[model samples]
Target chain A: MHELSVAQGIVSAALSHIKGTGKVREVHVAIGELTLINAEQLAFAFEIASHGTPLEGAILETRVIEARLRCIRCGREGKSFTCEECGSAMEVLAGEELLLEKLKLVEGDGDAQGI
Target chain B: MHKVSEIEVQEDLLAANRELAQQNRKLLDESGVTAIEVSGAIGSGKTTLIELAAKELKDYRIAAIAGDVVASLDAGRFEKLGIPTVPLNTGKECHLDAHLVSHAIEKLPLNKLDIIFIENVGNLICPADFELGAHARVVVVSVTEGDDTIAKHPAVFRKAQLAVINKVDIASYVNANPGRMEEDARKINPFLEVIQVSAKTGHNLQRWFNFIVKAVEDRKQHGI
Candidate 1:
């Protein structure tokens, strides 16, 4: 599934950001509602994707953001494109995103000292 | 003692694919090609729609990108119709990504094409998440697929601007309710244009043809 690919993506991202910092403790990710990614499934996918790598046993922390829509006519914010007041078409402003927010790392045998 | 530090990454996980999709759009725009991504369930008649378009539309030089998990059967069908087509095999992947499409586009005679119909591998879920950089996105669902299909697979339906309900001529035989299906789709996507047609019988297929024609015209006039 695509989740496996996405999971590997985050691991790579975390490692890149954590260069000489430490071994990864947790991978924090923020997903939008429109992406349709199931966090549980992604976590399961991360388990397999991170296997035997430096990120093994690293935590997968995902936060799903709700989609925000605005009416094209009245500029009303709502859940979908259809406006409740004037019944006009809505445009999505946010909530269809896949972002790797940050990586929580524990000190490793690197030059970086604990904060 | 364990020392922890939260390193800010702020990387867009889908940026790589999105970048490729943008590149594809740029290529299409430069080549003056309008692409329409046709996605649906396996038996939803996507290949048939392209074949019909190839037969009916006389004004444009059309090409196709047939995406299948394994064989080139759909591409072969398009080739038989004298449609310049590239067969894209995704192997283990469920849907066609922008990278594959970009390569497929390079393999075609872009200068000879007015439009390209990219027939995505038949599956609703994966394609919804990946942007293939087409000018328009349409999801084909049939009455035989059940009226509840729109409600069940709202993700793909939501992503599409058009919803086509195919095989309406046999609606009665299959106990299918096209009306309910349309309503279901409209409920999920208020702006989705729903068209009911039987590709086999050529019933109201002119509307689908017109949709493609209008898309190509709009792209040409407005410039994608």
Candidate 2:
């Protein structure tokens, strides 16, 4: 349930990135497999936080990546789904990421604000 | 009229929490309080161990921060012991992060405390992922929880500096093999300090108490 804290981070990051912009259209996030963040909950939290801010009505899109593990014993780089070589427990090298990947800010008038 | 534009961005979502945790860690270091965090499943007697410590360290100015989902009852229990206890209700959250701990610390008279104990929510899985600025992380397990807890939650057990096997008095009635539990924990964490105690009856509680006192004293001596 650290998702609320995680969501607050997302909102802060998005607001910082979109400062000076007119409004925010959407927020893009990248979630890794091992982060334990629930996307739906995060989205809901974002919605609640974005209210009355420049980010109101913004959509939250999350891109989830599978966890990757590196085998220390065999020097094998593979997916953690299962270790093909050595069969030893795999050490996670990446994909535990909880990142605010992209932000889409809206500015300018409708006629000139071609996306 | 609405306009749409895209901005490429890359940021870390946990940056804020991590920063707060770092700040709390610094505060803990500066205040000279050796912060110890304990995590375990429900009914593992985490609070009982802390209560035992509080009783033995009556001369020291001690404080505790307890994290629970639905209750301030645990903190109330600690308050009755005459220790300053801060309750962090995580709502639906499963664990307390550095931010909550730091806030709770601010509410306590941190400068006067010799040691602070943080009892993480009753969980073995989620608490391992977050660091709450503790000098030591102790993982408690009762015999009834199962002998294989160490093996089942290797992540938690591996990260723990000390693994406590509580309720040793009931080990026989529950058919729990304490030796096997210790061995399995050792296999996961060879450097772990294993202490067996029955907090219900004060069985070997002195060992646990002495461990905390020594660890706190050593931290002060080593300037950690």
Candidate 2 residues lying further than 4 Å off, grouped into runs, are: A20-26, A38-59, A63-96, A105-115, B1-5, B172-180
lDDT by residue for model 1 (A1-115), tens: 5787778778777777767747787788999998867899999999998998888888799998889999888999999646897877777788878999988777854334433
In order, the Cα lDDT scores of the candidates are: 0.87, 0.81
Model 1 CAPRI quality: medium
Q: Score the docking of each candidate (DockQ).
A: 0.54, 0.39
What lDDT tens digits, residue by residue, belong to model 1 across residues B1-224?
Answer: 66777888777877778889999988998899999999999999999998888888888999999999998999999999998889999887788988899999999898888999999999988898888899999999988888788888988887787899999999999898999999888877788999999998989999999999998888889885
The residue pairs that clash in candidate 1, if any, are: A81-A90
**Candidate with best DockQ:** 1
Model 2 lDDT per residue over B1-224, tens place: 55566777877655556677778878887888888898999889999899889988887788889889888888998999989899989888888888778889899887889888999999888786677878888999999987877778776775688999999999989888988899887766656889898999999888888888887887888755
Clash list (residue pairs), candidate 2: none
Chain A vs native chain A, TM-score per candidate: 0.86, 0.82
TM-score of chain A of 1: 0.86
- Return the lDDT, model 2, position A71: 69
